[model samples]
Target: MKIGLYFGTFNPIHIGHLIIANHMVEYSDLDQIWMVVTPHNPLKKKDTLLDDYQRLYLVNLATEEYPKIKPSDVEFKLPQPNYTVNTLAYLQDKFRQHDFSLIMGEDNLKSLHKWKNYEVILQNHDIYIYPRVSPEIENLELKNHSKIHIIDAPIVEISSTFIRENIKSKKNIQPLLPCKVWEYIDHNNFYRK
Candidate 1:
């Protein structure tokens, strides 16, 4: 099976995420999309994030109805400060029958060189890039690599940060989130200071 791993904090899983994952699975050659929930990202601030399980739960809630998309907690079992390369190595070992690829935005591609052992990731797995509203230029060599595929997915502008900020401000951000996720956040009073 060919799986595209879509890694994110998923502070709260929203519609934009679903749209991208669905698009990738249906529009591309990938058989499934795994929404990998990171326990801790080296580049992001841990203090601002909700509990890891809470975010994972939201991902579950958001993805339950989509058969092609599923939530993954693979990063939780591994050490903290998760790196894509390590997770990929573990998954490759465990699921020897599956061919794993990366699902990322154009912005992330621009900064791929900074990731730990990024060259290994590029060499072993194919990377599926989705469109993002990023102005930064990507490394030409990396962008044009045979293993890198720039998918013509929709340019989703919605972000978890935007959703969180609106929720904190008591704005009606229900449309931005999955119905179940929005309901859970409202009941639990998440992101509301």
Candidate 2:
């Protein structure tokens, strides 16, 4: 099986995330798209970030109906301050029969070169890039790399930060989130500080 790892904090999973994950699984060769809920680094202050399990639950709620997309808490099990390259290595070791790749936005592609062991990641796995409205230019070296594939997915501008801010302001951000996710957040009064 070909699995695409889509990493994010997903403090609260939203429609934009679902759209991209769905589009990748449907449009690309990936058999599954794992929405890897990134764990918060212990070194950083946990100001606006929700509890790890809460974020994972939100991801689960958001992706439960999608057959091809599922939520993963792999990073939660790994050592803190984990890097993508390490996760890829671990996943590859654990799931030897399956092929793994990355799913990221074009904006992330711009800063790919700065990531730890980025060259190793490029050599070992393919990267699927979704469009994002960003003013920064992508790295010239990676722009034409054979391991990187540009996917013509829809440009979703909605963000978890935006949704959280709206909820805090007592605005109806229902349209931005999945039904179950919205219910969970509303019931729990998340981000309403």
- How many collisions per candidate? 0, 0
For candidate 2, report its TM-score.
Answer: 0.97
* Residue-level error in angstroms, candidate 2, position 141: 2.5
Query: Which candidate leads in TM-score?
Result: 2
Query: How far out, in Å, is residue 97 in model 2?
Result: 0.8
TM-scores for all predictions: 0.94, 0.97
Weakest 10 consecutive residues, lDDT, candidate 1?
Answer: 133-142
lDDT of 2 by residue, 1-193 (tens): 9999999999888899999999999999999999999999989998889999999999988888998999999999999789999999999999999999999998889889999999999999999999988755453568699999999899999998888899999999998898999988899988999
CA lDDT, every model vs. true structure? 0.91, 0.92
Report the Cα lDDT for residue 143, model 2.
68
